[model samples]
Target: MSISRLHIERVRNIQTAALHQLQPFNVFYGQNGSGKTSLLEAIHILATGRSFRTHIPKNYIQTQQADALIFAQAHQEKMGIQKFATGEQLIKVNGDSIATQGQLARLLPLQLIDPQSTDLIDNGAKPRRQLLDWLMFHVEPDFYHAWQYYARALKQRNTLLKTKRQPTLADLEPWNQMLAEYGELLHSQRLSVLQQWQTFFLHDLQMLLPEIAVQIDYRAGFHPELGLANELQHAHSKDVERRYTEYGPHRADLRFKTALGDADVVLSRGQKKLLVMALKLSQIAMLHASNKETVVLLDDLTAELDSTAQRRLIERLSQLGSQVFLTTLDHVAVQQHLNDLSISYQLFNVDKGQIHAVEPTIYN
Candidate 1:
């Protein structure tokens, strides 16, 4: 799915902006603080009901504005999100109000690559786990429901553990049973998706980081032999001490390793970025193969990657039939690469919160 039109209001420095006839590849270029990134943020918010840049709505909402609005038309359906500074949100699809963000997210599956993307490697397991869940949520039809149920059970269990420091085994049985039922399902779903994702990931690794031999290691966060139910029962004391359910799918993680060590440790900064790109690109490839087109938001493309890497990334995205919205400081360089590849795109220049479509300069 691709956005054919987008309208934004009171988001960051962008007071109001609108674009029509967006192409498969859309490029936005400008200097620092020119609102290019803000434009991408608007699209991200519209799709996910949250900003990649910040968790606080007031931070992204225009200064002095009470709320920020983002609306878009994807194919025949129209989706919109309005985030208020008071932490309230209004989401609607096709002019009807919606209660959950998942409804909107299902309509638009977005993959974002930004300067901070390297955190996937260097940071903790949360981001990596999120990567896996993103794929599972899109590919596995039942994954979301399972995840919701598992999350509720996990929360109840953790709260009981925290409130009643010495809660009896009987007290925890119900939550354990719920956790075992849904947790196992989540683990199974994640493993199934990961197995398929690994094939695509390896292909992308060969293309993006051919020299580096990388392996994906998945931790189910519970002992496979004893199973989650038995483990939860056995770890009751530990859970009580920690005030949380420690062993479950909630703590699952994906680790990337090379012969030398973890990718974050062995690879250079540039290599880490490429590896992250490969991970995301592989997800796009897998989704594309399933006939689910992904919309990619690439921030500061030229600054984050070298020319060759940039070309390779763009080429791969195009081949996967991904609709990409890219932000760059050098439109000419990006335009030249797109021209060389004979890729059709819409070029826009962002300045002082204003966005204007510009004609591309053709080169021989």
Candidate 2:
């Protein structure tokens, strides 16, 4: 679904802004510190109940403000979020209060491509695992509940390991059973999604990085032969030594590899960025194939990619029917590219804590 209206309040430099009649492509342009990124952050907060900029609410919420508010309408459904400085949040859909963020996420699936997106390749496993789980959460209907169960069980098991120095098998049996049950379910769901995602990923790789041969690998975080139950039983001693559960789906990772070595190690900085783009764009394509449209948040469109790459990226996104919100410093450059492709878009010029829509110029 695409957002038609967006409202923001008390968010970073943006004290208050209301945008209406958003098109398939919405471009925000301004100088540094012009609150353009904050506009995208507001929508990210509304979709996921958090900010991509900072984890702390006080950093993104305007100084001295009690909370930041974001609201949007997609068709007849309305979603809103209020994030307090004290780390409390209230999410609502269609004017009714909601308990979980998944409800909002299921309605509005967002794919974010920012300066930090390369962290997926350069950083450790958590971000990569999160990327995989985000796909599972969207495409797999039962993934969220299974993940909830596995996380709860994993937490209990870890707490037990920390508290009891010599807990016997019987002491950990119940939690282990729960973990194995849910963890195995999560593994199956993730494996199925990953297999399908790899197909789409390879196609995008060809289009975006044809010269590079990259392989996506999945580590299940457990012994494939022994299974989670058997592995947990075998790792009891190691678990006590480390004071945490070591092996399970919780530790799963996705490794990007090439003929020479890992993608991060073998590829240059620019190449790594393109690889990350392929990963995210492939995900959008996969979801689109299933008739689920994704809202893409692209921060600094021109900075991360060259002119040719930007044109290809925009063309791919347009072909997939994604509603895009992008930020850039050069409006003329971005507008020129969009005009050359004959793509319809709405432009908004952002200033210090304020935003104004710029009427589009017709080009023949």
Q: Candidate 2, TM-score vs. the true structure?
A: 0.98
| Candidate 2 per-residue C-alpha lDDT over 132-219 given as tens digits, one digit per residue, 9 for 90 to 100 | 9999989999999898988999999989999987888999999999999998889888889999999999999999999999999999
| Worst 10-residue lDDT window, candidate 1 | 300-309
Error of 2 at 282 (Å): 0.7
Native-to-model Cα distance after best TM-score fit, residue 69 in candidate 1, in Å: 0.4
lDDT per model, in order? 0.92, 0.92
lDDT of 1 by residue, 1-364 (tens): 9999999999988999999999989999988999999998999998888899899999999888899999999889999999999999999999999999999898899999999899899999999999999999899999999999999988999899889859999999999999999999998888899999999999999999999999999999999789999999899888888898889998998899999998888899889999999999999999999999999999999876889999999999999999999999888888888999999899999999999999888977
Residue range with the least summed lDDT across 10 consecutive positions in model 2: 355-364
Model 2 residue 16 CA deviation in Å: 0.6
Best by TM-score: 1
